[model samples]
Target: MPAEPLEKGQTRFALRAPSARRVAVVIEGEAHPMNRDPDGLYSAEFGAPAGTLYRFRVTTGGGEELEVPDPASRFQPEDVHGPSEVVDTRAFGRPDAGWRGRPWHETVLYELHVGAFTPEGTYEAAAGKLDHLRDLGVTAVELMPLSDFPGGRNWGYDGVLPYAPDSSYGRPESLRAFAAAAHERGIQVFLDVVYNHFGPDGNYLSAYAPEFFTDRHETPWGAAINMDGRGSGYVREFFIRNALYWLSDYGLDGLRLDAVHAILDDSPEHFLTELARRVQEGPGAGRHVHLLLENEENEASRLLGGGSSDSVYTAQWNDDIHHALHVSATGEGASYYSDFADAPVARLGRCLAEGFAFQGDPSQHRGNARGEPSGHLSPLRFVSLLQNHDQVGNRAFGDRISESVSSEVVRAVAAVYLLAPQVPMLFMGEEWAASSPFQFFCDFDGDLARLVTEGRRREFQKFPEFSEEATRERIPDPSDEQTFLDSKLVWDERGDLENAEILDFYTDALAVRRAEIVPRLEGIPGTGAQQRLVGERGLRVQWPLADGSLLSLLANLSEKESGGFEPPPGRLIFATNDTGPDDTGNLSAWTVAWYLLENNS
Candidate 1:
């Protein structure tokens, strides 16, 4: 929760600065000394109403005085390095009164970055497109992070203030209105949140409260957060409260925790578990509130028996499925793709039938065991997709999967995953095969800008394609304004004949998933999915549904036709190329077919 408002328009302001000898709340250029408690918390009461701009002046133990924005600021109107503004959260009227959220089995996520989603690139602008998303069969809109970052333009990962939404998008009430607009259209809204590390710039916690971080564990960014070290209880409470604030105040339906594998904690009660328990007891108690994760470790224990009332997490982004699908479609065997290159068809089958392809298996890329057994988990616990922000933006050119493969191949892969039992997600502009590339762009200046641009190009130096200096220079600089402009989607392309056909293909597939598959997913057992390889690039997988029926998929991923397979048993529900198998038990090149077998006993 944010700072509580007291009677007579007074608000209580508090800051944890145990290492500071003196602290004062600077409101409207007037400083008021704060009283320090035994726990090292400085507190002050002021008659500051809503929209009051203030900063904290702290005198450190070394006798250095500096001003910093409130760590729990509700809104930062002037980017990260400015004064924080008090917001009246209850002023905004609710958008929808009848939105109790939908079930997890019916989630068809459309992930989008608010900046590039529309030409206006504001919360109100994005909300206007809910009709298009609803018409395209998107049940939920998974927004990239909105936390306050360093500059005007960012991917939202480099955010410093977790409580403040970047002002470049819109005001805090604008985000609340966006949620209300989504709920009116029966679309659930989910936000991506980064809890592992803060951005490199504008983080003021270490200066006043060094105990917020610990040198015990090292992360990719820096020293790990003090989750299990001394004075860790308050640190954990800060993040947990942040999560609850977004869900309760903003009326968001769900949250996607980004890269939680880096949130190292060795306490008896893991932070993740405690957060989930608090959420389930909080806002989640009244309505359906889903919690999703992005964990590279493929930890199935956190996702066991998920999407139910008693589960810790609802689902995880299944990178194994995406990697296998990308390797099979494009035949690119570089970097992490090498793990799935040799037998991409087999690996794809395993990912579709079971939850993971590397269940307790050795990962040649990492030179270690990668995952736990996930065969007993329901496929819905895995969120499957072909392209996402990291898969596309991290590339030297930020080329999408459609850029590397034929349209036929893209259609075939889309057919396979869109109808699979796993929850399906689509990257923004993917439904129409948008031509714009989602390049990595930022708005850092001076030395930081140069370092980030150089670092971006250097990351691809190990690849043979970018080994030369000339080739590396061809990669766009992350700080370039044109790079950001080039990434915006061209809405007019949807009306083009070729793009419209692709859009229609996706619409039909998602419609089938909603009408046929979502109804049978409620009580399906986790252990009944099975798979078999048909030929070199052919796969046959099936899952027994809760209603004693069977759902099956047969796919030929290669450009060559595959034979020596009997006709699949079940009534054909959807197909990419043909209606059924040929007389010689042959499936055409790049074809996918889904079937349903009814139990007539």
Candidate 2:
């Protein structure tokens, strides 16, 4: 049931509870019984002002009474178990009316966690850093989940309350302020939202509406959300409303859906397709909205609206690029990396030439074909990243690439994604190479804490490094406060010479990319960029320009220098090595260089 807004100080509340025998709206210790309709919907009108705290007193089918917050609450001052506050978005109003968002193809995204990005760990603190991101050439900031989870610290994937911003990160107005600050600087903001499963703690939907979940499908977390069973219409409406709330109320530009593959729905119109249509052609029309998915299944059809011309998502996260790069850099192929182990460099080249490496190919890691053909899609339909939260935090030690590989190697890898045609995303500390690690962390108390720690340890047991007991002891406890503290980015380190060198490399690369590639991207060949393997461990990509010129990037992926090769017909634009153009045209180990060729050659 929707919470309808009336006059300034009034709100109309309605709830649907078929199993509830009696329901009352208890506001500030006063009880008001709501009138019920024949369809099991209870309605009540209160003289309550904004910020008034209230909850529902629900009498169960068997006469057991329970007190729970509203399923559609916009704000929870006391979190999940406490009273829900009335948040009138109509009161605060939209901050940036001139903000229509930026072009999706021109976007250079920077993903960050609000808590670990700065020492203050609040929306206000994150907003303070917008100038820094603007200077780094970041067109948008993709924040990790901010939905209200159980405790003070979390990765945000375990959020239970989809509507309320976590109390730990200030109030609802604080988030609005952050979005306003970003838009004022011409930077768009997107929120990462989880719809796969609710957090283990503070999930009250099942307590009142068991029909919200179904045993027909099982997710890695637990029972899947009901999208096609009895009572699924309201369940579907509940999530779609949450998406609209964030975009219209908080002024967010887009949403990065957590894992769409696990959202098992068998309806005539898929949930994601329906969500896209509502956001694009519904009330959100005339406002630019981007929808991105993190679907591991690599279903290219989703980006194409499942072959329907009416619906479409903006893009999908391309994990094949990350896995191939990881195998090439670390040279450690054990679990999922086994598929890319044989020809890691070639795989990386293919990913650059094409959008995905495993498109319809049999993967040894999965023992089956993993992805569908993605050749017919635009390069902008895939988002590539070098280091994301999952790639770093899921590690046994949560170590960054700066700690695992050589500095020169890291620079080459950075140039590959930043200059490629696809959309590039940078993790929080990747630009400056911050020393802190983004480890797996949570704040669960009592027995839950112990169980979470044990589960984490068991997850890493398959890795040969964590097979021994002593090795397991070294694994940081996910429940410890120290783990969260250790993950905060050290902002001061950006000024150091070692870190500044890497940061400058990224800034210059992005500048050259915008100047050369972004303009002529729309009309590129359907086969994507033209690329050829250079010798044994080298690759050269030629991006066609409108003026009949080419933007060429050459790199040596091996540890030894590859010499005696003629340079591409162009003036050198960028090189990872400190030196400029050489007499012999030799490329050092783990070096990448970009050049611009004119119409002459």
Candidate whose TM-score is highest? 1
The estimated TM-scores of all candidates read 0.98, 0.96
Show the lowest summed lDDT stretch of 10 residues, model 2: 302-311
What would the per-residue lDDT of candidate 2 be over residues 335-438, giving only the tens digit for each residue?
Answer: 88899999888888878776788888999999999887776666778898989999999998889999989888898888888987788999999998889999
Taking all chains together, the TM-score of candidate 1 against the true structure is: 0.98
| Candidate 2 regions with alpha-carbon error over 4 angstroms | 1-5, 304-311, 522-525, 545-549, 563-565, 578-585, 598-601
Cα lDDT listed for each candidate: 0.91, 0.84
Error of 1 at 382 (Å): 0.5
What tens-digit string does per-residue lDDT give for candidate 1 at 405-455? 888999999999999999999999999999999999999989999999999
